[model samples]
Target: MTLLDFDSDRLAEFATQVRGDYEELKAKNLKLDLTRGKPSSEQLDVGEALLALPGEGDHKDADGADVRNYGNLKGIRDIRELWADVLGINPEYLVAGDASSLNIMFDLVSWSYAFGNNDSERAWKDEEKVRWICPVPGYDRHFTISEHFGFEMVSVPMLDDGPDLAAIRELVQDPQVKGMWAVPTFGNPTGITFSEEVCRELASMETAAPDFRIVWDNAYAVHTLTDEFPPIHDVVAFAEEAGNPNRFWAMSSTSKITLAGAGVSFFNSSKANLDWYLATAGVRGIGPNKVNQLAHARYFGDAEGVRAVMRKHAGSLAPKFTRVQEIMRERLGEYEVARWTEPEGGYFISLDVIDGTASRVVELAKEAGIALTGAGSSFPLKDDPNNRNIRLAPSLPPVEELEVAMDGVATCVLLAAVEKLGA
Candidate 1:
């Protein structure tokens, strides 16, 4: 039975027992971190072959461009084609860059601030006020970018299918609303992909701002942890078909696929958006490290090569994710003080604890030296209005470590819930 149904005497007894367990955990002086969705050392080892890639005298791309030297500002064509095959977009639509897709996203925000996109009345910085819609229980870094630019961040709810489209439709009536962030496939914490209907509706929706842009950060497109995962629909095509071709700026990277810091990053969109982005981005550099790009291209010969790498990643990742779910189910299943996601792909599992107790649970976890992602990291401005969500990052730690940490988490969650009920 859930704590909500527990009689006063039973709840009090449970709370007292949990408090004792918490004390013993604190005395252990343990140290375990689950704060970031970083790849494990074993996962990193899978891509170690990339270090020796594009071996001696192998500096030329397929088009005969000298990768050792500077010139192709947009990126090497062959590499773009490889990524294009993965993203299901044309090679011409892709622009390969250095390792961080987050950096690419920030650059677009900066560019929009200074110059605006082709349709803007003026630079976003010059506007009286700029606002952006942020789907909550989302990637915190995405919210950080909007905050960095001084945009008023509107919090939208994230449903099982995706962000609430009806809410989005209502919010876009404000002309000051300039942009939004989306992690369309296997979203950071929630792990929900947008439905095809929602994608098309967003692509075609009329916005009060002529330059409304969607930063489509599809970071986990190929990361599948289950056999039954569905392929994501083509949002770029959906937008183009709706006659809003320039409304999107899609970004992806091999940061998780190959090496976190050494992999390739890419962006894709309609011709006008690409031209606008390049005209500004080209001034920032001669070209991305083509040597690195060539190394990745050779490392993954084609689309199938990329898929093979992700499978190896899943082999290591699935176990950790499974262990987290198992521990949560065993410890909290009967009490029902918390609920968590069983994501098919992606690096996080989102946990929603009893109302008003998530922060307390994190505080208790930290005292035990088991580091979890801070309470409310999934929301814009780090504010979980209900204060009920906690993001569990199981990828960074080994399974044995993750299991122990999750047990500690279960204790904290149960203790917090009982304490709240007693109050």
Candidate 2:
């Protein structure tokens, strides 16, 4: 029966059984974490060759520039070409950066504040108030960058296909709404990829801020878990066609494909934005870690080589994601107490639990020694207005441990549902 259809007696019986299961889980003293979408140790092993690259006096780049020296402000040309191929952007528009794309993103925001973009009226810090459109249930780190800079974050709804363009079109009418954070492909925690229609509209939309930016964080561009990967529309091509070439900042990294701590990061956009970024970033440092960039270029060898590495990642990761879905289906499918996304490529499964019970479920899971991403973390200020969505990161755990942790999570969901139903 549906949860709402359960009679008082039936609800009471279900609650009692769930309470018993909860106690048993507590007794086991199990410890499992589904907190972060970290690559498994097996996944890390796939990129081991990156460590041995550029070995024994092999320090010159393709153009014979000594990589050990520091002069290529836009990074070495060969590595830039490799990433350009991997990211499907023109080599001239893209620049290689250090390991963390998050750092690159932070730097972009900081630069925008210190010195406005190529077309801005003034530095963002000089504005009376700055606002940024943030899609809901997004990467917390993305929200963190805007929040840290004191941008008034406007939460936008994330539809199954993409962020609500109708709403975004309207929000951009205000000049102070300078930019928005977007993960166009396999978005964090939600796995929603923007469709071609959405991409075209985003590129062509009218915005009051000439410097309006779309921080297109394509973090999982090639991190597919299945053969039928979702098609990612080219934002750069679309934006250029719309005569808004400077409207988007495309970012990506090999953090998941290779070593998370040591992989390369990239930023691609219009020449104006690229020139502006280079002018400011040049003042900060000479160049990024070229030795590491050289190693990555050789490690991947070419675009096809990068695909091979990602395929190996899929082999190890796909099953863990599948197992999580199967358990959730078997245990909670009939209860109708929750719903979740079965993503094709991303590292997360966005779970929306019974309203008003998500916090209780999280509390119960913690008591049973199973850690989950805290409720409402997907929203700005770490507040989910409905208090319903919970991000489930299944990539970190092995299948067996995931099964155990998921069982405890299932029990907590049931117990919380029953309590909320007043059984």
Candidate 3:
């Protein structure tokens, strides 16, 4: 029965049992962590061949450019061609960068603040106030970048198919609303892929700001847990057809596909946006690490090679995800005090406990030596308003440890709900 169905006395009795379970969990002194969506060692091992790539003076790229030296600010054609196919964009519009896509995103915001983008009337810094559309239960890191830029983040509801388009359409009527952030495919925390209709609207929608941009961070573009990959729409092309050629600053990386810190990063956009980025990025450095880019290019010979590796990742990750769901179902399903997403492609499961009880649940888990991503982490400024959303990352832990951690988490969720109800 659901916890709400229980009388005060029965609830109290059940709370006693849950408290006892929590006590046992605490006594175990587990050091399990479900904090971040990091790939497990087993998953990382699948890309171990990357370490030995482009070895023994094998540094010439497709155009015979010496990758050992630096000059191609647009990145090597070899790697760009590989990822362009994966990202569904033209190689000419794609700029291969260093390992971290986050860094590229940061630089884009910083440059936009300092100097205007391709179509900007003026630099963002000149604005009275810059506001950005943030879809929540979203990526905390994306929100972090917005906060770093002093942008007033406006929260929009992230729906099953994508962010609330009706709300986004209304919000963009303000000239102060400069940009929005989107994951588009297998979004962080929520794993919700934007439908083609949503993509088309985002591409075609009218906004008051001429320079309005969307930071399309497709981090989980190919990180699928199933045989079928989600359809990757060419939103850049959509924007072009809609006369908003500079609307999207698309980004993707091999960070999760290969070594987290050593994989290549990519940025795709219109020709004008690419030119603007290169003009500023030229000042940041001569170019990205061509050697590492070459290594990645040699490692994954083509788009299909990348897919083959992802299949191996799915083999390792699917079981852990399944275990998390099973444990949650077994332990907390009947209580009906919490709900979580069943993501098919991404690394995180967005969990919502009873309203106003998420923080308590996290605290209970921590005291039991299981670390969870802080409650409200999926919202802007770390504010959930309801204090109910929790991002559960089941990718980093093995199935055995994940099973234990998830059970403890379920116990904590139940305990927190009972405590809130009792009070």
Candidate 4:
């Protein structure tokens, strides 16, 4: 039976017993964590060559621009070319920034509140209280940004395929609704990609707020754990075809590809949007570190180089990811009471348990010394309506320990679900 069927007084009674059992079993396991989506230090080693790239002989680019200099506020030209190619947008349409695309995301949101986009009128904050639609079981960080700024976060149901477009469409007419957060490539926590139809719908929005934007963060564009590298549906192109030049802002970084502390970040959009962002950014700083930009240009010689580096990341990360999958398969995949997303790539596996049990399950895991990303973190303001969504980050643990940690996590999931439903 599915997890829902076990929701009953009798099942809840039995589940309490199961938790009691798990509490006893847990004493045997010492400690582990399946939280936080950072590359294992070992997995991060794949980009070591980036530290010493572009020797003295490689300083000058084909455009006669000294990559080492810092005058270009829009990032080194070659850097834009590289990211533009990687992001699938024309070079002229993109304004590549330095590390931290989310910072760029923040700037855009802040700008919308302060200044309008595309020669539009009225500031976002000055307008009616802003509303944002967030796909539940989403990236917590994205939701946090909105909440910290006081944007009313409305939860749009996230399905196995993507966010429910019908729900999004129904609310687009609400004048207070201003934006949505999207991670198209491989969404954090859930790992679901937006369906082509949904992308088309969002791009073709007829909203009361003309300043509506889609914060497109493709953090895992190339870091797939799956064999096939599925391409994300391009919503920007759809928006243009739908005649909304400023519909979405595309972002990415080499934080994963090259190095985290120092990596190139980028943004892509229509010309009008680029001009607005550049104007706003001119006040923030003169330029991002050019040396890092040059290093990326040299480290990733071309588009093919980006892919090659990603393939290496996949090779290193896959083994770690597999350990969690194998453990889930062994412990819960056949039980029918718990289910997890089997992503082709991306750093997370989203787990859903009996409604209202997620937070409790996390507590159980923690009592035994396993740290999980807080329950409801995948939802807006960390509010999972059903409290069933849990994000599993398996990329950090060593392979052998990851196996045990996942087993412990599954035990907690089953225990929590059973307890909640009296299973």
For every candidate structure, what is the RMSD over all alpha carbons to the true structure, in angstroms? 1.1, 1.1, 0.9, 2.7
Better of 1 and 3 by TM-score: 3
Write candidate 4's Cα lDDT for 317-397 as tens digits.
888767777887787775566678888788899888777888988998898788898888988777777888889998878
Q: What lDDT is reached at residue 24 by model 1?
A: 89
Better of 1 and 4 by lDDT: 1
TM of each candidate vs. truth: 0.98, 0.98, 0.99, 0.92
Candidate 3: misplaced stretches above 4 Å? none
Candidate lDDT values, in order: 0.90, 0.89, 0.92, 0.80
Q: What are the runs in model 4 whose C-alpha is more than 4 Å off?
A: 1-29, 56-58, 421-423
C-alpha RMSD of candidate 4? 2.7
- Stretches of candidate 2 off by over 4 Å are none
Candidate 3, TM-score vs. the true structure? 0.99
lDDT tens digits, residue span 98-132, model 1: 99999989998899899888889999999999999
* Candidate 2 vs 4: which has more TM-score: 2
